[model samples]
Target: MSSSRSQSIQGTLPVIAALLGNGFIAVLKFVGFFISGSGAMLSEAIHSFADTANQALLMVGIRRSKKKATNEFSYGYGKERFLWALISACGIFFVGAGATIYQGINALIRPQHADVTYIVFTILAISFVIESGTLIVAYRELRKTGGKAKFKKILKNGDPATIAVLYEDGIAVLGVVVAFVSILLTELTGAYYWDAIGSIVIGLMLGVMAIILINKNRALLLGKAIPEEVKDRIIEILEEDPAIESVTDFRSAIMDVGKYRIKCEVEFNGNALAKEMFARGALREEFEEVRNDYQEFIKFCVDYIDRVPRLVGNHIDKIEKRIQEEYPEVVHIDIELN
Candidate 1:
């Protein structure tokens, strides 16, 4: 398969896995909640349901982001991924975290004993295993793109689909642990408020994670630039050409998950232009008399000026090709002469 196709598949795998896992786990959590009457279990059930829906939204983003460019959106639908991710973040905060917190506070005010403790423990253990598996899949995909970067850096710079799955699954696993501990503590001490406290903790964790995701997506939607190292590498490539004296300025923006639009201003070698004019038999000395004649000089100057842009354009093309070969993520490039 092509690299893009491979990347697309890799990106989709986490969402699909999360959707399936959360759907199954949500049902188990609901059943466990009904059996044990545990506040933590109920919160977990709601969290799993929210996770399933969030995975669906991510899948939509991934598919829509692949849409072909139209006249109205010449950059294509890449930013749709970030938009949908932001929506998903809000969903987690409101539906998952908000509901959980409210339920926890209500339970704390009116405590209720939880029975069937064994069932809740079993379900949480199973959920933990399943969530761990999903997290492993996300981490593997992240590693493919993240190289040696730390986990927080990966979450910041990685693709939205993978990042969403990683965050959701990681939080899910931690939620399961909290739920398990809360149930165990409540059963041992006969204090039902522990379960409510666990629910509150899980809600707070999800809230923090949602905020992080929201900020990352917002930055991308606002046209975050590619990494500084990447920009520097591109500049290095452009300056490698002898015809380019210096790269005066460089700027880039992320157009999609793995694509960018780069604009650069480069100063061309003055001697190179002089050499070209000499090679074309347009030496200034040859045109000395022509320069004295206003009409002839004007015509000659117009032709020379016309040829300069073409030569500069050809040099820019070479530089663009080199950058593209070095970094396939750069899909659009605009080079201006300085």
Candidate 2:
């Protein structure tokens, strides 16, 4: 199969797994919350539900992006993935963060005697099982693509699949911690409000993370430039070519989740002009050469060249004076090599 198709399939698989696993967790947490009247458990249930919705949104975005380009939309709907992904982030903020905070506020205002032990233990145990299942699937998905890279660095750099899984796992772990702390506090002091406050804090934390994801994804969707290190790398490669004198500027954008769109401006020495003209079979050939050298790190390169003009006026004056004094072709003397 084609590489693009393989990438698409691989990208979609983890989202599917996340949606399924999150759906199961959502139900479990909701049931656990109701049985034990644990505010944190309820908050987590909503968080899972929101996450499921976000996964669904991601799937929809992915599917939309796969549609063929049409007359009205030349770039097609690939950017829809960004829009949907942003929506998912909003969902995380509103559903996950909002619900948790609301429960926390309620707990603070109207303190209730919570059976902290049951809520904490049940959610903690189930969170481990459910989160472990999802984490395993995520790891399996990521491992195929060359073992998971640095979690946040990859997510921030440009690996959407890894980003999604990392986001989910990271948030789930935080929720567990929040639940554990709140339950412990309540158990120790018998202040039921502490559990509610914990739920709220977890919500806020997830909400902030959601905003960061949204901002990062927003930049990509809006055609943000590539990292400076990548630009420097490209420039370094170009400078190594003897034909190239110097690079003026370079820029790139994320065309899709992982695909990149690149453009560059360069300057070359006078001697390189002839070879460059001879080499211009088509733009794609030049792009292919660069792509081969850089592999997946670089999608392609666009090049332009300029040749310095000889100053005939000044050279002619000097040559005429010297030639008159010496022997040469008297009639329309052809210029000799200097």
Candidate 3:
């Protein structure tokens, strides 16, 4: 679109690195948590585990969304991408934020001094670097599709999977920063509650990220309409045809992430159709054959009128083909007489 629009931009980058990085970081975070018994480290571990789960869920969606259309699902399984995204949000809410917050509260109730300072710090340093690397990769891939596109554009029009990768990596990086600060504070101040507070803060961040992801995915899963600019472009394409005088009852909705179904009623110009037939010399030959007899002319006129629907249908097919040439995302088109 020339401007703002809500449509999924489909791609398959930024997933592998984020998935693998999260998986590796999750193991290290758990190791640090068990060794140090710091609430912040434990929270980071849970966050990383949730991220690992997110990768698995995203992979599930990517695979399932590729399934061929079935009788029961005539539109195919494209929405399944958003389906697992929704599920990942739910997982983040419960497993990531919920567990982290609970652990924070538990640590607050029963505070414990952390141990193995150097090892815990080393783990956090590595986690931060890994998460940041994943974030950078995700951003680079985003630029490939977005290319100076603002965050608003990506949020409104990006593929859910890519969005998940970028957003999750971002939150992961922030979570690691919070974890590092909290642990460092605990080490300097000897107050275990600082670690607990860090845990709670990380949980809050995940909660917010989860909510945003849930809402975005829900809109997509429910077949959100394409942007107004997109609709106007299609309409303009239709009206550009001389045979189409006007358009009415235009409607479009997502069939898959990037694909759409468009339906509309078009007012065809009878004179234009006749002119087209004249240009083809089909009507001139018929008129020449019937000019001698009034009865034969009436029969010919009746036959010509009877085939008007087929004539209009042929022109519509051509228009549809042109539309496909102009906008390939328009996979399904339904043009009706107005």
Candidate 4:
């Protein structure tokens, strides 16, 4: 398979894993909550359900992003990934965090004792194992793209689908741990309020994660630029050509995951053009004498100016070809002569 196709498959794999895992875990959590009457268990159930739906939404975004370009959207539907990711963030905030917090508060006001503590513990253990599996898959995928960067930086700059799955599963694991601790504390101290506190903490964690995702997707939708290192590499490539005097302006924007559009304005070396014209015999000392004759000089100047554009065009073509070969992520490149 091509690299892009491979990347697309990689992007979809974590979502698929999360969807399947969460679907199973959600049912288990619901059963645990019903049997134990634990607020934390109920909160975890809601969180799992939200994650399952979020994965589905991510799949939709991935599919839509692959749609062919139409006249209405000449840039294709790549940005759809960001749009759907944004929607997923909203879902986590409202459905996952908001509901959990509200339930925790209600439980706090009216304490309720949990029954069948052993069953809750069993379900939490199983959920942890399942969530850990998904988290492992996501972390591997992230490492493939992230290299040695910090986890937070990777999430900020990585593909939206990968980031979504990574964080979702990570939070699920942490939620399981919190739920287990809260149940243990409540059972030991007989406070019952500890379960509610766990629920509230889980909700607050989800809220923070959702906000981070929202900001990242928002920036992407607004046309975030490629990394500084990437921009510098492109500039270095452009400057490598002897015909280019200097790059006057350079701009870049992310068009999709691992895709970018770049625009640059470069000043051509006037001396290079003069040398080429001299070597081609289009510009000669004879032209200097022709300057004394207005019509002749006009004709000579026109012919020389016409050849300049052709040379410039050829040079621009070479530069563009080199850039595209060197940077496969650059989907579109616009080079202007200054």
Candidate 5:
């Protein structure tokens, strides 16, 4: 299969896995909640449901992002994933965090003894194992893209769909732990508020992550620039070429997860470019033969002048090609002569 198609499929793997895992865990949690009337278990159920929906939305975003480019959207549909990720973030805030917190508060107001017994433990254990398994899948997928770099750096530049799943799965694992502790406390002290507290904590965790995802997606949608140090490296590459004097007025923006475009004004080293493209020994010999004949010399000068622009154009193409080779993510490059 083609690389892009393979990449697109790879992008969805974590989301798809999370979706299935959460869907199953949601069912398990609901069953546990019904039997034991545990608010924490109910909250986890709701969280899983929200995650399932959010993963589905991410899948939509990934699919739509693969849409072919058009005149109306010249940069292609890469940002489509960011738009969907923002929507998913809002879902986490409202549907996930909102409902979870509201449930916790409602449970707190009317606390009740819950007989989770040992069955709830079994359910939570299963759920925890599944959630952890999904989280591992996400981590492995991220490591594939991120290599040996720190996870923070990877997430800083990772795909939004995959990153969102990673965050959600992490929260899921933590939520299970909190639920386990709250249920244990409930069994120990005969106080139900601990269960409510666990729910609230889980909700707060989701809220924090949701807000972060929202802000992150918003920035990416607005075409956030790549890191300055990376941009500096790109600039350095351009100026290192002898035909180019310096690069200025540089600008860049991410077009997608791992793709971006750059624009800059370039100052050419005129004498160096002239010598590289035009000052050939064969040309010098030809010029010497034509110097004594007025018509021939005039023709030579005219032909030389005519070829200059084409040669310059070719050189510019070469420079641009080299820049792309150095930074493949620079899918588009615009250079203005200064």
Candidate 6:
């Protein structure tokens, strides 16, 4: 399968798993919240609901990213994932985290008499089952992408949707614990406000995580650099080409929609025109080989030059200087072959 096709499948798989998992948890939590008047349980329910919605958005993004480039959209929709990822962050913060915190604060300020032990316990139990399933899917996906990295490294370098799912699993698991503690505390002290406080704390955490996801996606949308290893690999491939004498400079950019547009400047020894063509073709073929070997490569351009070809020189210093101004990369020279 093409690397792009494989990546597309990989991206969509996790999203499907997350959506299914979160959907089940949402239904269970909704029922649990209804049975138990615990404000914290209600907040947790909203969190799961928001996660379900976010996963749906992520799935849409992943699918949209597969659209081919068009005249109106030259770079294609690969970066659509980043855009939707940003929007998902907003929903998570506003709907999931915001609502939870709002309700929790209200409960704390105005204590209520609501028994929610059954709802809390049952929902938490179901959450474990659903979230675990989703987390397992995510881990499996990670392994395909090169296994799990350090937490900080993953946070810095991993895909936003993948990272967001991880956040969901971790937070959801912790929220369960927090809910259990709050329920026990309220039961022991008969202070319903403790449950509310627990809910509020969970909400705040979710909100913070959502913001972080947003920021992370935002950076990627703005065109972050490829990983160092990938950069080095690209360089190695270019250097290995026999036609390329030495690479003077290599630069790359991430255009909208996750397309990599690269430019390189290299110095080479004078060679026959036919040999140059052969070498260029060979180098491009090598590039294709490398791209196929690794999944991350997008696209590139290579310029091979033996020397700065002078158009006007010696007696025509002024003209040479003028030509240089117009085309900085070119040199000016005049040749007379009797």
What would the TM-scores of all predictions be?
0.90, 0.72, 0.92, 0.90, 0.94, 0.75
Q: How many backbone clashes are present in model 3?
A: 0
Model 3, residue pairs in steric clash = none
lDDT of 2 by residue, 175-290 (tens): 87787788778888888877888888888888788888789778877887655655566557556655556767666666565455555555645455445545765456665556
Model 6 agreement with the true structure over 1-338: per-residue lDDT tens digits: 75445655655667788888888888887787777777877887888889999999988887888788899987677778889999999999999999999999999888887676665686788798778778877766665664456656656766677777878877888887887788778888998989899899999999999999999888888877655665566556545544345657666544432245545565544353337455557556656656764443433321223222331122224433443443332221231211
- Model-by-model lDDT, in order? 0.89, 0.68, 0.84, 0.89, 0.88, 0.71
Please give the lDDT score for candidate 4: 0.89
lDDT of 2: 0.68
Prediction 1 TM-score vs. true = 0.90
Model 3: lDDT equals 0.84
- Scored against the true structure, residue 40 in model 6 reaches a CA lDDT of 76
**Model 5 RMSD to the real structure?**
1.9
Please, what are the lDDT tens digits per residue for candidate 5 over residues 177-214? 99999999988999989999999999999999999999
lDDT per residue for candidate 3 within 140-246, as digits (tens), equals 76666665768677567767777788888899889988998999999999988999999999999999999999999898877788767788988999999888899
Per-residue error for 234 in candidate 1, Å, reads 1.4
Error of 5 at 235 (Å): 0.7
Ranking by TM-score: 5, 3, 4, 1, 6, 2
- Output the better candidate (3/4) by lDDT: 4
The better-scoring model by TM-score among 5 and 6 is: 5
- For candidate 3, what is the TM-score? 0.92
